[model samples]
Target: MQLFAFGLNHQTAPLAVREQVAFNVDGIENALRDLVENGAAKEATILSTCNRMELYCNAAKPEHAIDWLAEYHKLPRQELEPYLYTLPRDLAVKHSFRVASGLDSMVLGEPQILGQMKQAVRQAEQAGTMGILLHKLFQNTFSVAKQVRTETEIGANLVSMAAAAVRLAERIFPSIEEQNVLFIGAGEMIELNAVYFAARNPKRITVANRTLERAQTLARQYNGHAITLSDLPEQLAQNDIIVTCTASQLPILGKGMVERALKARRHKPLFIVDLAVPRDVETEVSELNDVFLYTVDDIAEVVKDGLEARQGAVKEAEVIIESGVSDFLHWMESRDVVPTIRALRENAEHSRRQELEKAVRLLAKGESPEKVLEAMSRGLTNKFLHAPTHALNQAHGKDRDNFLDVARRLHHLHNDE
Candidate 1:
């Protein structure tokens, strides 16, 4: 089966497009089943984060997989076409390895992507969508990722997007110590941002989420406060730094709402880092002179230059990944021939067993053992040579030359012999 990866990511798609297509955990399993049944793929797994929405699959037709993604997201193929990237086979395997190893993350060398990928695999397994091909590919993916981390400085001296948010916040006010930071969402990205912001000992910290309990749990960790999403508009003016990452398909903050917050904050320079894939803040808010709009990709740019600081290790990482890619592809190739190999071995065994059974029966009937043994040896030789003899006679041209060589090799029928 051909392996393919088709979808959008931080590089190909803007947040507007990627967010529209992001799949939640529950949505992933259903989408995977839909793909397999729709003849789009035989095995599928979707890895959806705020920054990327990639579908990895084993398939006969890559286009069918693309169509499945478009149809499921209810997006027009024409519109989706611009942002979608399609990788076949080797490139697909390389992309998977890159993504899982944190090389493809918004923050280079971050470890979160590895964990996220493992979660995706577990979800695929639970849905029964992970087949031998996908299972082995991911098994190698994790191993390669681990090797990259350990063998190279790929993860060294890396600045996380969350940490960069804090850096940007420092630029707004002379000191983060005086400002109150409000983190919007309780997701991993938000949690990380909040932790970084809280370390500054902000005047206060608050977490607002769709669920009050989740918000409360996160807020309590930092000795701050929790509020439901409903409180955001009213509470917006009170915070100086706002970091948001949520799974909401729609914009959490509109331009008008933020404008109102800016008006209330009295033209305060609000440092806003929207880590959400689709975005927590509306695009129009970026137009505001006083508001800073930092997207996931925007944050990615800040840490990018620093990754060069660890360039000594990249060549080593490539070697490790190459070896892993070779091993994984070899395993994938073997899977295709496995059944044929089994059938061939069974055929050979069956032929020998039948001849041996006949020999044993003759001996049981008190026939001469020597004649029985000779007959069995002749039967075994004939059975072994029959298929190759037929193949050599039937094949022609390239097929004939190849099969003749194969047959000669099989029976040790060399010119010298």
Candidate 2:
């Protein structure tokens, strides 16, 4: 099977299209197993983030994997086709390196994609779908990411999505210190945003998650209150600023929920950042007069704060990634020759064993040790030269010249010698 990757990312698809294919964290292992079990791939690892849904696989027919993706998501093949990008072999290797190094992220040089990729690899491992090719690819991928981070200023002055969310909130509110901040979901994204918002000393901070324990764990870190997702409706009205990123398959904050919250707050403006891919807030919520709803895509502009400075390091990072890709491809190419090399060694060993047995018999028959040793050495030399000599003798014209050249090279011979 060949190494290949195919998927749609934020660069090629809008948030709406991306969300349709987004694999929830809980179902990632199942998705990976299905991809391999369905024969679309020999091995597969899926990297699903807020910005992209990509599958890197070792497969004979990558198109079948693409078809599987659309089928799995229940999206028409035609509908998903426009945004899809397929990379083969070397291109796939380079793309993986670029992605892991954060060159391919919506927010350039952002470090979060690296962690997300590592998570994808872990999920693939848990699913038992990670085979040698993908394992090697990601191993090189992460190594390249580390090299880039160390050799370049790609991560310096990085404006993360969480920081960007806080910046957007600042625009909406005069003072974060006075506004009540409620974070929906206690995942990494929420925790990140919490760090940024908490630093501002918001009047009240709350974390809402599917499980209260997880919520409480995060809440206690910021000296905030915790609530289960079921408490959102009642708690929604109390917060002036809301940041949400959850793995829920459906919109958690519907238009009606926001409308009720707005009414309870006497139509005071509510700033909401929905960072989830399968959005936590309904699109219609953006239409509400008193509600300012921002999706992950909407945060892109704000996240460009240090983009100019980071761009300078991109070329440096690309150089490192390209070198990594070359090294990985070379390793793959060497692997391709391994079976041939093994067979060659095994064949030579068989010849040696046969000759040694004969030598033993002659010695047992009272031949001198010195004579036996010389005979055995001659036998080994003849056995090693026989195939090439026979092939060179049989060859004619250009083939003869090719065989002669190969024989000389194989034995490291020179015309002078």
Candidate 3:
């Protein structure tokens, strides 16, 4: 099967396009089943993050998969063509290796993409869309990622999104120690941001999640209290800084809600960072007076602050990925020849069985043992050589010479004759 990886990312597509195509974690299983059920691919796995939405699949035609992506997102093919990138065979293998290695991230050498990829694999498995091809691809992907991380200095001085969020908060407020920090959602991003902000020993930390138990679990780690999404209205105006990232399909913090918060605080400047894909805070929230709002796309610029030091690591990382790609492609090539190998073995077995049966009948008829064994050996030899001899006789000029060379190599013949 032809392996392909196709989609758009932070490099090929802008945040506007990325968000439009981003898959909700809750809906990925159905999307994967749609891909296989619709004949778009034989095997598929989707990697959707705040920065990228890539679909890797085993298919005969990569174009079919690309069309599936456009149709699934309800976008015209022409609109997505400009931002889409399709990598076939070896290129797809290399791209998968690079992505899992963090060489393709908006934040250089970030570790979060690897976890996101693992989640994608799990979702595909649950959907029953992950076949042997994808299973082997991901297994190699995780191995290569581990090698890249362990063998190189790629992750050194990494500027993670969490760290960037804290840096942005620092810019707005003189001292994190003096500001009250409110974090929305208890997911990985929120947990990470909580860790960074907690380091500064903020005045108070509050985690608001869809489930209070999850929020409470994360809150207990930092000696903070937990609240549900419903508490936002009464508690919103009390915090000086808010960093929100949740899986909610709709915006959790609306313009009117924040406007009331601003009025309650008497127009004190409020810093807000919305790291969710659909965005927990409304876009209109940015238009409010005395409010500084940053989304995942907005933080891309901030994350680039220390990227120069990591450039050297990127070259090293690419070399590791190249080695990985070569190994994986070799494995795929071996798999491709499986049918040929099985057919060859089956043909040989049939010839041997036919010759043995004749020899057994001759021995049962009381023929000389030596004579029967000699005849069977001759029959087996003739059967093995017949096909090659016939082909050689039929060949002309270059074809004849090429067949002769292959026959010689197959039989381990010397050129002395």
Clashing pairs in 2: none
Per-candidate TM equals 0.93, 0.97, 0.96
**Each candidate: what lDDT?**
0.86, 0.92, 0.91
Alpha-carbon shift of residue 25 in model 2 (angstroms): 0.9
Better-scoring candidate (lDDT), 2 or 3: 2
For residues 141-200, could you state the per-residue lDDT of candidate 1 as single tens digits? 999999899878888888887778888778778989898889889988888887788889
Question: Model 3: C-alpha RMSD to truth?
Answer: 1.5
Q: Tens digit of lDDT per residue, candidate 2, span 1-417? A: 499999999989999999999999999999999999999999999999999999999999998999899899998999998999999999999999999888999888888999999999999999999998899999999999999999999988899998988888888889999999999898888888889999999999999999999999999998999999999889999999999999999999998988999999999999999889999898988888988888888888888888899899999998888889889989999999999999999999999999899999999999999999999999999999888889988999999999878878977989775
Off by over 4 Å in 3: none
Mind giving the per-residue lDDT tens digits that candidate 3 earns over 38-74? 9989999999888889999988777888888889889
Best by lDDT: 2
Q: Rank the candidates by lDDT, best first.
A: 2, 3, 1
Task: Tell me the alpha-carbon RMSD of every candidate.
Answer: 2.2, 1.4, 1.5
